[model samples]
Target: MKVVPSRSSEWVGPVTSQKRASAIIEIDRVSQVFQTSARKDHLALSNISLTIEEGAFVSILGPSGCGKSTLLYIVGGFVSPTSGAAKIKGQAITGPGPDRGPVFQEFALFPWKTVLGNVMYGPRQQGVRAAEAEAQSRALIEMVGLKGYESFYPKELSGGMKQRVALARTLAYHPEVLLMDEPFGALDAHTRTRLQNDLLNIWERDRKTVLFVTHSVDEAVFLSDKVVMMSKSPGCIREVIDIDLPRPRRRNELLLDPRYQKYIVNIERMFDESDEAGAPS
Candidate 1:
């Protein structure tokens, strides 16, 4: 049956309701803890409350040991929370599921498998056939700027290239949301900038919900629509900075923007206020 197009509903989803897709994921007053060897408890995240809209590019930025990664793991379903809830599309997250794709900083690719094979591994486990999965994997690899290196193993690729393979692997599964844990943190400055631009291109084309964790203020500002800043020592969200910068932002142009520096300074002040010792201006 052929459906008729309506003038009012050019955007996807229900005609009357256009909220830019339901809040794809939500973290409500959640806390995470791990038991110390001394038999005491250590809180990692403390009451992290946030909502990520579908197709939005969001970044979580904080200092070292602020539980930024722990929060990301909870959203990715790799770890359970100690209190409160993490929900995806109104459903509570129980454990790891294919609906969310996680790209780690270490670029965990299989040494034995070729790049193409590694990317196809996820779908193959989900019962997808070899031929189709391979084709899709190749497309993704090429999309991530690793076209001709499909036959190379993880050991044969550079640090940046290995990360590309890991990201390709995550995309091949066709996940609804992408959880990136400092994917570019391991790369040198030059390679990191290149990958950051590449990732922005991919995000524009695919438009998937993404929650990226990064320590670089510039990176967080460049790649995100909103930057969620967390406090240190039993982390809690301190601020959320909305990036009014234009889309498809170039690295040089974005860095040169005065607003960029302003936002960075504001985030720094937030951290200072959260801590007992505020940095002298």
Candidate 2:
């Protein structure tokens, strides 16, 4: 199925050449801590730092309990760091705003609303007029392959479909940065793979700065320009691996490419050598 992108999001190929690289989002020595019921301070992240250039698709890969999601949350402004800061365009992020849109592991749609209503919710709240919001929402619904189900409520949709709605909703508001935390983690193997490819197409078209978190090696290898691995417990960057493979990456070809396999192996080695838990590449 073809994704019908709105003219507002016209195609810019996956590997479009740019004049100069510039950092759009900066994670500066960020750390996070939580107080346990016993009053012990539980440190979740320790001095994590990263800089994502504009229009780059970067993935945060780590095992369970690695605090990857916490890092993404801080960047999304849904949570504040204990120290340091998450900044976008050189401005410190204080709270959730229109500039950065987040799609979580769980689909957070309103059960009472239809698919169209859910997609339109963000723009309407942001003060876009009804007619214009509907036009943009319909285009996004088509992009995510939910055009025919516009009137269907969340209860009527499958897990993958609900996630698609969540994605469509996020894209409808035209965020410069898309912060996704395990958006496809809940889906079955086939659905997960399908969405991964589709997401690549969407990213290629829009060129938004993507900060994605996942435990899957194949996912990181196939989708990201850079893959940053994290350590266990008090998560910190173990290594930042650059994926040198050409973009408009085809999954079947990537599976067979020697460089792709090397990247996967190197990523796996980072975890194996460091005693950090990980999934098979």
Candidate 3:
């Protein structure tokens, strides 16, 4: 797996009168493996290291089985690495905490809950009063452009709308970091594009630290300030490309740009090479 240099040096943590803050999430020399049968081992991630600045948008891109989702879970504290450290701010992440919110691709909304109820759930768990949670939920629902859908249950909403509620629920927690695992993967192409644009718009406004994982190269290039490409199998950082493209980008026009295509091709080549290496000898 190819290793990428860190671009997180620019990320300044929350300011205080004394010491300066650090990156919101930092992974150093992380390797994760799972055991199968009696002794066979499968390394899902290997020697991966990266840092995400507070409030910066970053995406992990690679082909399937590249351990992208595993990396996301590591950041979310849902799983621990077999070795190395995953830290939030300056603290070690040993388990899940309210400080980091996660959005799964499956939407994962409870079928029994209304949009507002789903959004309010996080805050309620965080010990916020019912009324306060409701108010926060209402504002976040509107922020995700789901204002009128508040009373509707998950089953009543379209796939895109359901994901929006899931997103709002994560936001309602007001997490210091947000982790998303291909949150738009199941949507139709048109819906995917729309939701991608909407997500970028909301992100720019909300300015939360985001660590998004996806196999879609376009999605990574479109939404992230930096796209961290990973190698397949036993995933590791291949390259960290600074997007540098103007924000609020139009999909049609940006896709046509030669520079945008360059990043996509670069990531594509890495995936192809990794696949070749992983093939049976």
On TM-score, the leading prediction is: 2
TM-scores of the candidates are 0.89, 0.90, 0.88
Q: Order the candidates by TM-score, highest first.
A: 2, 1, 3
Query: Which 10-residue window in model 2 sums to the lowest lDDT?
Result: 1-10
Model 1 clash pairs are none
Candidate 3: worst-modelled 10 consecutive residues by lDDT: 11-20
Q: What is the C-alpha local distance difference test score of each model? A: 0.84, 0.85, 0.83
Question: Candidate 1 has what TM-score?
Answer: 0.89
The candidate, 1 or 3, that scores higher on TM-score is 1
| Runs in model 2 lying further than 4 Å from the true structure | 1-21, 276-281
lDDT of 2 by residue, 1-281 (tens): 11121233221223212322477888889999989899999889999888888887889999888999999999999999999998898899999888999998898998899999999999999999999999999999999988899999999999999999999999988898899999999999999999999999888886788999999987987998778888876788887766667768889999999878877887787678777344345
| Per-residue accuracy of model 1 over 74-127 as CA lDDT, tens digit each | 988889999999999889999989999999999988899999999999999989
lDDT of 3 by residue, 164-227 (tens): 9999998998887889999999999999988998888888776788899999988998888778
Q: Per-prediction count of colliding residue pairs?
A: 0, 0, 0
